[model samples]
Target: MTEIKRPTWAISNPLMQQYYDTQWGIELHDERALFEMLCLETYQAGLSWQTVLNKRSAFEDAFHHYEIEQVAQMTETQIAPQLKNEKIIRNRLKLNATVNNARTIVKLHVAGRTFDDYIWQFVDYQPQRLVIQKDENLPAQTRLSVQVSKQMKKDGFKFVGPVTIYSYLLAVGVVNARLD
Candidate 1:
């Protein structure tokens, strides 16, 4: 049997290795999937990706599988219990922002725009691949991320700072920061 070689960031965990090889940087067109990643990135604001990946299933269960309309309808009353969920990150602010972000996505739908279209427009509907010469050269947050984060904030999306938005962009395949 042969072992697969993965990036250092993913090699530490089976889930991370799988996510990197199969899911990460793949173009995701589904609104639900996009919303899920965005929310996951939100929860990962102060944690590691490994932590979020480990709890992805719990999050999906708790947040209605990231269904835009369903999660958008999540009230504070409904979300109150998630703060105590031992399986998930259990951050009150991140949990609240999940619902808030879902509502914002719903508003986007109300305006006849799909969350997919609204997000892809920032890159002019193209997935960008960057040139990375080394790990040290990789960016935590780019100007583009800052721009998107600012616009998202203006549109009432919470927990979307530039660093988080950068990760979201990478996760959704709006930008491919995969190292060569």
Candidate 2:
């Protein structure tokens, strides 16, 4: 029997391992899923990915499964309770940003643009596989992320800084940082 060699970062935790093996670097073109990852990465700011992954279900439940229209319609009345919810990150700003970001996506849809297209255009609708020798070689942010982050903010998104954008890109497979 032979064991598969995975990046050290992915092997330390079961949840991370499963995410790495199943979801990481896989091209995702679904708008709802992309929104979910963006919000998750936003919540991940100043925290670890494990924490966000652990609370993902709670976030999904709280935000109506990251449905852009549903979340965009979430009023303060609906969102106020989440600040007290122990199951999620419970950051008011991040929660608000989630809803705001959803609204941004909805606006894109209204403008006859798809979040799938908007995001994929950055990579020319192709996944970029990078040659990473080790986990340490993974970059926190790249020029692409910076450009995307700037455009996202200009497009009325919130909490989308370069680092978060970089992580989101990796999560959605625009850029594959897998060790080779």
How many clashes does each candidate structure show, in the order listed?
A: 0, 0
Report the error of model 1 at residue 156, Å: 0.8
TM-score for candidate 2, residues paired by index: 0.95
Instruction: For residues 111-151, write the lDDT of model 1, one tens digit per residue.
Output: 99999998999999999997554334557899999999999
Highest-TM-score candidate: 2
What are the models' TM-scores? 0.93, 0.95
Candidate 1: residue pairs that collide: none
> Model 2 off-target regions past 4 Å?
1-4
Q: Please give, for residues 9-99, the per-residue lDDT of candidate 2 as tens digits.
A: 8998899999988788788998899889899999999999899999999999999999899999999999999999999998899999999
Tell me which residue pairs clash in candidate 2.
none
Q: Listing every candidate in turn, what is its Cα RMSD in Å to the true structure after a full C-alpha superposition?
A: 2.2, 1.6
Q: Show the lowest summed lDDT stretch of 10 residues, model 1.
A: 130-139
